[model samples]
Target: MSASNQGRIGVLLVNLGTPDSPQTPDVRRYLNEFLTDARVVDMPAAIRYPLFRGLVVPLRAPKSAKIYQQLWTERGSPLLYHGLDLQKRVQEQLGNDYLVAFGMRYQNPSVESALQELRDAAVSRIIVLPLFPQYAAASTGSVQEKVMDIVSKWWIVPSISFISNFVDEPGFIETFAMLGKAEMAKHDYDHIVFSYHGIPERHVLKGSHNGYCKLGNCCNSYNKNNRYCYRAQCFETSRQLGKALGLTPEQYTTTFQSRLQSRLRDPWLQPYTDEVIKEYPAKGIHNVLAFSPAFVADCLETTIEVGEEFKELFEEAGGKHWQLVPSLNSEPMWVEAVAGMIRRN
Candidate 1:
């Protein structure tokens, strides 16, 4: 091969990550690492580090560990295994011409290690797919920042590209629409809910295009002004998925989930998943099907938080058959969705 074609392209699949094990220590370590990151906490090191170490990690770790315990499986975390399966599938799909690897933003199978592998392969360029359908600073933003931080240190950095958000990508929509179709066939659900992972309102404003994100009705319609807005992208994801699922505007609701307040009276995204489900019972919506497209893998957030906890909440609020549509894991369609994204990049 000529010098211009000396190296193969590298593809890195990144997910948020999970604790090494379900144990409290591991969970605590994971939480500490995750929350301490400035991208996540979005606080100064002097203030954030002490608060996370002294208060947040100590209080939330044990509870989170139990949740991770519930989320754990013999194959290990759903996020990790599914990511590995995706890596293998994408590699096979692309054949010998390309190389693929999976990395976690925190804990085992670190991004640094994955990048090292790619460097060893001597890939001339890297394509990063941060397994988030919607763009958010805390998720995809953090992943891209980490990748940039790592590769910039290299003596010979290759060209790098990131697929920031694919909220409306055809394969992504197809995979999610396909899952919704199966779930709908199983039950006569009274309502449909699209719950994306929540980020702080401030983060939304920070990424706002020319002060475009008012966090009010701006998310109601997606446009050029709010193209990179997390809230807008989420709403757009729901809109596209709704069209594919044959759902009218009144047939479903878009909401947010898994919010963590960074400061006193600090609000994360509104129309929260928990609050939304509670109101469903009063509206005589007994049965509901939920979709968490922000999460590509069935991790603690999807399987436990959305599937179990929200189901319990909905039931306690006097609803029946609160079912969560499983995430787009390593199934063939999802694999194709992922593979197609990588190949296109």
Candidate 2:
């Protein structure tokens, strides 16, 4: 191919999706597609297939739709809006050299569409960056799988590269710390909680390197064996952010949130969010600040779960104050950080 025909470089930003509408049918469609993914649910189809199709989707969709409705804005899903904004900001930062596109893994503006846009643009080199800062089989791995799957059928596939996880990236950590400190300065918080979205224990073990991850101190302490470990990554993210914010180990805690039903001996990150809120009073911890660094965009999880639900629980538990640090959204600094990452790659 001629040099002129090779085309521009392309960057696709992918995120977990939101429903097409705040309606049960739409939510069901989105949830069914999301939960059915083997990467997300992580159970064999023989087991999860019926459970997802027959039970969860049917029962949860309507309820989830209600929750999503509460999160919807004039522009539509907060996730979609912020993601679109991020795309524009990143593109503007990178100037005209790169073609930028955004996609939701489970809904409209699908990965297929995004990839097609890049392909049609004749992008010679394509970079896939999942918005998830931390890597998990269900999130980053799934995005990678989908990208490869789509490219596999193409007549001419571009030179594709995937940015797996940038949890420890200097710019990313700095952005997170800056946000956390800004939130903390507003009040005297006795506890700073780093709450990450939870994955099933089986999912963690599945990714473990020959039983290397016990999901305990072994996971918390940084070591080569557990370097790519998702649980470990969460801790490291918390630690780095704490250090940047000048928080001592005693002032901060790391835990997991949003766990679905599962029976596994291996613990998800300790001191679940609710438990942490409830225990804080007894421990003499009054004001609490929560940071959900795992999420790059504000969504139902951060808006409803952390902002409202957890705030209610914390207040009801005799805690004086409960505050949530907002997601990065389209902050100029965050856009610059992401743009820097793309350029470095």
Candidate 3:
């Protein structure tokens, strides 16, 4: 195919957003937009808005701002910068045939703006790749909803498609496995933990195909019934990564982390990362290597929560050498994987 024929494809890459700045006000603005989204919070506007703005944002923002302050680096948010890097390299890989734009679901470089860029390029079709490997209502679903909402109003709409979930994609599995292997080469890790962001239990049930998800060992295997179930997808991603890295079932544990609020009565995906980390030292599992596969790039959750906080917990509990295998941020294989997925879709 000539370059002109390949130019027919437009690619938009989306990720969960980050605050523009680590300042309290900026963080508050981010929290306000992110939490207020019904897909993330999953409550009616009456309850969601008031509770998030009045209670959650106020309580979380300043503390989160401080955490963000620590998380920020010379290039600003690692998440944003890495995403930009991925965009540039992926564009190069796809060559002149593709126009690749990156955007966040919440803050700067908003999803609408990214889609507009693609629309302006006048590509015949646009493919949206939400960076979340495991689909969830709050992440991928919200992006799908917003993209359709924006394009439906266009005077001339192109054929829009979404690459929703790619848990079984070989490129994704191989890339993550390679990262894990690199870390393993440096340290004799006693155990591996695959941490993914936690969503409310209701989110899983909402995606349940005829009650296939019971939130237990039901996720041990992947199948059509639980394909879109975020929890199941998380497990599957871990399973594939584990298999790729030559780990047995007992050698690794897959758990959820970063629940929205600890006080919320509603349960979330369990075996919380924090709780599980605390128990590891007592079990004689020292020297752990952690993987945050759900995140394509290292962000607050991977850098601060998993790398720092969990390391502290493990050390305090008498463990030694807690290390984090960094996320795939513009890693060449990852870029190739993304490009191939785009071509396939």
Q: Write the per-residue lDDT of candidate 3 for residues 1-345, one digit (tens) a residue.
A: 765765568899999899999999999999999999988887789988898899989999999999999999999999999999999999999887789999999998999999989888778789999999999999999999988888889998888889999897998889888988898998898999999999999889988999888888899889889988999899999889889999999999998898865656888888899989899988989889999988999999999999999999999988999999989899999999999999989
Per residue, candidate 1 scores C-alpha lDDT tens digits across 1-345 of: 742477788889899988899999999999899999898888889999899899989999999888888888899888899889888987888777678988999988999999999999998889999988888888899999999999889999989999998989988888889988998998999899999898888899888888888898888888899888999999999999999999999999989998876453599998899998998889999999999989888888888888999999999999989888987787787787777887787
Clashing pairs in 3: none
Report the lDDT tens digits of candidate 2 across residue range 27-130: 99999999999998777899787988898889999899889889988999999999999999999998877899999889888999999998888887999999
Query: Can you rank all candidates by lDDT, best first?
Result: 3, 1, 2
Query: Per-residue lDDT for 164 in model 3?
Result: 96
Candidate 2 local distance difference test against the native: 0.88
Worst 10 residues of 2 by lDDT: 261-270
> What are the runs in model 2 whose C-alpha is more than 4 Å off?
1-6, 262-267
Reference-based lDDT, each prediction: 0.88, 0.88, 0.91
Candidate 3: segments with Cα more than 4 A from true spot: 1-7
Q: In model 3, what lDDT does residue 113 have?
A: 95
Q: For residue 92, what is the lDDT in candidate 1?
A: 83
